[model samples]
Target: MTTTGKIVIVGGGVTGLTTGVALLEAGLPVHLVAAEIPGPTSVAAGAMWGPYLVEPWAKVRRWSLVSLDVFRGLSDAPATGVRMVSGIEAARNAVSAPEWNTLLLGFRECSPGELPTGFEGGYRFTVPLIDMPVYLQYLLRRFREAGGTMQRQFVGSLDEIDDGSVIVNCAGLGAGELAADDSVRPIRGQHVVVKNPGITEFFSEDTGLSPDLVCIYPHGETVVLGGTAIDGEASLQEDRVAARAIVERCAAVEPRLAKAPVVASRVGARPTRSEVRVEADSRSDGAPVLHNYGHGGSGVTLSWGCAQEIVQLVTATG
Candidate 1:
């Protein structure tokens, strides 16, 4: 078969799905393949807003801005459970260059009441938090509606995508092995989803302690309490110790949540790199490949913008 009519995308994570949506929007056909059951997106406690947190990837902040608008415009925003939320983001002392604070609406000082212990002072901003399970389903639905196709198979290398002239790789942590990308290591994040009706808002702080900071956000049926960032860790076995640590730290931040029933615990390895990669390159076997991985902890936060860039790269090459 000739490798020219369609584009093949590897991976079914948030990055892959969003890139598929963007490419379809740009008038292209896509075939997405993954090893596991094509499932929903997940991991992490809260989605941090603004560009300041992303460090050198200042474009990530811009991409996040555009992505928020895209998600807000989607017809299923309410059905998919995405919400424009306000949260308290604190820091003990400011980093030399914050990447995102100034980019948000109402980015200003948090009132004395919102301040948690150990935080000197910080800002409050309204940002979008993605309920990944819902959002991933939304993206998959859109891709199917746009005439995209999916295959269930593990692609161990770039050669497996020979059905297309161009392949966009968004394979998350798999890139570490598949692409021989040493930078694409996993950052393990553990969180607890609880049944808490009393916690209606999101609260977070930069506490320098075990399990580090705490963030609590409501997602319709469940409340997300999180989390800890264990860099270079790739275990998804749901550590009981980590789960208990998350719950305790979160309750310490918001005493009311202490009474909430823990519904379930989840662990995911975030595909992390020093920077978010959304550039075009050739695979080892000389297949045209556009890489759109390394989202780290911000995959959902900046999906659309990076997708847009990926689509542009593919289109320009085509």
Candidate 2:
């Protein structure tokens, strides 16, 4: 049976939607309140790969793995836009890095001939990529069917929730304000969407260049080519210089993409923190408040695992 009290989830991004879906599936009555209209992350290029220049949180990786499986199991909602993708990682340097090396499936030494670059070896593996748009709609539909209620009301504070109700803060960067988390800063990521190049794989490079770098992932109708990680930058404006650099870099990697037409550009701020917060707080009336944001560039990569833990936190509280 479902629980007795109402559970309100804040933020309409991946974390909020996934938490709502999990709760509803478990027969819990849920209500979602957001100050903004839901749009893009659900329809993202959806590539779930990781272990790059940065050392990601272990829990985050675990959650991403679990989410990878969940997205893989769903068949009917092909539009939820999830798919398993094989990826290749190559470095221009010969130095071996253990942390990133171990994350791949076939972590091995590449022959000189195979090592086609400015220097080093390579690795390969497969992971899930979620089409955020399809997944978001699917989530909304599922929540509605399970009797969950959602509104466009922007919650100013945790006290705005009713007494005795559990409030989950999944407001993404908005949590910096909503949860009073000063560490939550916006890491802006910009992408260029192009017509499909008929490529099914994902390729990325990390030379630690200037304003941007190249990341190419092919989806159902289009290919995502881009990425500039501008920390503390909140401007949603498109960076054409960065966009052109990305296109040029990507085209250099695989010249075929050069011919594809640019359909659109996207800018999203990855909510980053020194540590991803997923703990319980309390409303003024002593109602439980669960904080679950800060997945940064890995939100899609880590949704389910985080939601599962949040469910456990809420369940244990009762």
Candidate 3:
């Protein structure tokens, strides 16, 4: 729709930044405000591009595929920190192939020999694995270069935003308070970064419905080992116990990780909901509002697709 001012996007994680970039690329004026841009949580992700624990498979499938295509294009640019890496996602118990397997390149069931020692069933495919820290900066730079502006300030409530601007509520976990969305809660995730001992491919355990996850993602010199998904847990403090467990679990699957020196630990609370929110609303002051959060573990996986949808929502409003 026709706007009197620039679009204001809340939350500055991958969701907000990606949305900001999309809007700018669409030739719209955009302003992003957040307490912290390039949010720590986004930086701390084991951000391989397979939809993990997000929901509403129908829409997620579409969004994830769109993002997969975009990431594939971005992979050609090393500065974007996107890579097309082949990997195995296996399970210790018998399981059906993932419904989205057909969406990836070179989709195939892993042969028994291809499966790690204890994995009973799994699939092999190539997907974009992101180095989040570098990627976030790339997004930020792209946003600024496109003439988008940002403010590093706390946005307490939607009511405080009275400007006649379209509001994109990407506040993530903060949406629980800003939008009064009780369904929005935190799913605590922890990852351990270890020195990469000459590894190239990625590996993940298909731990369905389990709080603990086993995954190893190598990014050049460092590998990110993950993770835990504790629902309703919001604390960002590093959990040594969880870190140790992550390293041990990964080491079991990839013996080379056994002696990898510990580098760092990361903890983030995924903004999880019963289903992802990517729709429109209105503020009390009658300003247009678009909700785009609750991505859970698939924030990076769904960022671009969701951003594109937001762009359409903005156009429809006009």
Candidate 4:
């Protein structure tokens, strides 16, 4: 009943699974316990590798870059559900390139003709687009192969962890309660999946200025059209109106999406904060605990980087 010598990790989403892999690689016995695997949130993500809404530019850049490399290595491994796809991000105005742009393949400013009407500028790059369900399963298989253990249950708080084990909290939004973090809140996102209309690439626009999402992520026979990032809202109910809006906007960008039959709708509550927490802390009794959550929309994009740092923190503090 005790995992005294094991490194216990909470959460079974991408973050926790990725952490388990990294910890096992660092030669540590791992025990992962979470309420869900291939979690409700991550499974609903329109997950592409872009540092969209995470913070601390320097750390985000570093973490995203490391993850980019890791994902690229997995691109050819079809079972992993990762693909290197070219996409365009249209900006209403000119902007500087992202710091991690140097790490992507074929990243460059878009040509004048490439910009859709009303877009002043944009950039095209090839980045890793993840099919979360498949990728999460792959992570689970890889974790077990590395000799890690997992349990399906709810953890009330950090105090429940075994006394002699070093704990890593990759508990995503649940960290709000587990770690007493008031800063962590949900940024609700929704996506609509449709039968692919033979679209071969991906497309997205910054939804900050716009009131709705205009994006399309074609994954083989199923193309994902989304989405909505309504901050502080965590409801998972299917919003027909919102789904309609997503389809309409995406269709305006890619006409084929207008006719693709709606296959499904997904919802997720992303853990958002001013910045990601990837540092070592302690419990009331001074037991070592390392936090690795608040990744917002960049959980997959920052997974390996944060996991690598978690390993370093454990090595230094263990």
Best by lDDT: 3
Residue pairs with clashing backbones, model 4: none
| Candidate-wise lDDT, in order | 0.73, 0.72, 0.91, 0.88
Better of 1 and 2 by TM-score: 1
Winner by TM-score: 3
Candidate 1: which stretches are off by over 4 Å? Answer: 1-4, 37-45, 48-55, 92-97, 207-211
Between 2 and 3, whose lDDT is larger? 3
The Cα error of candidate 2 at residue 35, in Å, is 2.7
**Model 3, runs deviating above 4 Å:** none
lDDT of 3 by residue, 1-318 (tens): 556578999899999999999999998999899999988789889899977767899999999998999999999999999999998999999998887887876899899999989889998888999999999999999999999999998999987776538999998899778888898989999999999999899999999889999999999999999999998899999999888889899999999999999999988999999899999888877788999999999999999999999998887652
For every candidate structure, what is the RMSD over all alpha carbons to the true structure, in angstroms?
2.9, 2.9, 1.2, 2.4
TM-score for all predictions?
Answer: 0.90, 0.88, 0.97, 0.95
Ranking by lDDT: 3, 4, 1, 2
lDDT value for model 2: 0.72
Question: What's the lDDT of the predicted structure labeled candidate 4?
Answer: 0.88
On lDDT, the stronger of 1 and 4 is: 4
What TM-score, to 2 decimals, does candidate 4 have? 0.95
Output candidate 2 Cα RMSD.
2.9
User: How good is model 3 by TM-score?
Assistant: 0.97
Sorted by TM-score (best first), the order is: 3, 4, 1, 2
